[model samples]
Target: MPGRIDARLQELGLTLPVAAKPIANYVPTVRTGNLLVVSGQVPMRDGVIAYTGKLGAGVGMDDAQAAAQLCLVNVLAQAKAALDGDLDRVVRVVRLGGFIACLPEFTAMAMAMNGASDLAVAVFGEAGRHARSTIGVPALPGDAAVEVEAIFEVA
Candidate 1:
C-alpha cells in the first residue's frame, strides 16, 4: 500500500525514480537526528539527463521549470531511500536550494524554481512550504538546466 505522500505523488501523475547514484564521491542523502539532507539532484529521468543547456540561451521558461520539477522528484527519491521507502516519515520540507544554469541576463530563476516549489507544496500540503534559495549558475553537472537540493525533517 502506498503511504500518504506516495499516494499524493501518484495523484499528481508523478513517479519517483530510482534514487540516483552519486556522480562523485558524496552520498545521495544523509540522516542525522530528525533531519535528512539530500544532495543536489539534476533533471534525470530513467537514467538519462532530460534537460540540458543554459536556460536563457536554449531552454525556455516552461522547460526550465519542468527540469526543476524533475530535480525535485529525484530529491524525493533520495529522501525515500534514506527513510526506507516510507515517504510519510517526512515531517517537513525545511528548505530547498535551486541552481539554474542560465545566461547572465536571465532573471527568471525564481520563477523557474517555482516549478519545484509548487510541486512540493502540492505533494506535502502545508508541510511543503519551505525556505528556498534560487541561484543562477553558469553551469551545472551534466550541463543540466536545473538542479535542486533539499533538507527534510523526518520522523
Candidate 2:
C-alpha cells in the first residue's frame, strides 16, 4: 500500500523522479543516527538538467520557482532511496538549504525558495515545517537555476 506521503503526492499531481546519480564522488545521501542528509539537487528531469541559466537573466521568477520545486522533488527521491523507499520513516523535515543561481541584481532568493517550502508542507503537513537557509550564488552545478538540499529526521 502507498504511504501517506505517496498519496499526498498523487493528490497534488506530483511524482518523484528517479534519484539522480551523483556527478562526482559524493553519495546522494548520508544517514547518521536519526538524520538523513541529502545532497543538493538540481532541477533534473529525464536524465538532464531541466532548468538552467541564472535568475534575473534568462530564467524568470516562475521558472525559478518551478526549478526550486523540482529540486525539492529530487531531494525527496533521494531521501526515499536512503530510507529504503519508505518515506514514512521520515519523522521530521529538519532543514532545507536552497541555492539560487542569479545575477548580482537578483534579490528574490527567499521568495523563490518558498516553492520548495510550500510543497514540503503540502506533502508532509506539520512535519514538513522546517528551518531553512536560502542563498544567492553566481552559479551552481550544471548552471541550474535552483538547487535544494535537505536534512530529514527519520525513524
On TM-score, the leading prediction is 1
- Range of the 10 consecutive residues with the lowest summed lDDT in candidate 1: 14-23
Residue pairs with backbone atoms closer than 3 Å in model 2 (clashes): none
Regions more than 4 Å wrong, model 1: none
User: What TM-score would each prediction reach against the true structure?
Assistant: 0.98, 0.98
lDDT of each: 0.95, 0.94
Model 1, residue 80: C-alpha shift (Å): 0.4
lDDT for each residue of candidate 1 in 1-155, tens digit (9 for 90 to 100):
99999999999999998898898999999899999999999999988899999988989999998999999999999999989999999999999999999999999999999999999999999999999999999999988999999999999
Kindly list the per-residue Cα lDDT of model 2 for residues 1-155, writing each as its tens digit. Answer: 99988888999999888888999989999999999999999999999899999988989888988999999999999998888898999999999999999999999899999999999999999999999999999999888999999999999
Highest lDDT model number: 1
Where in model 2 is the C-alpha error above 4 Å?
none
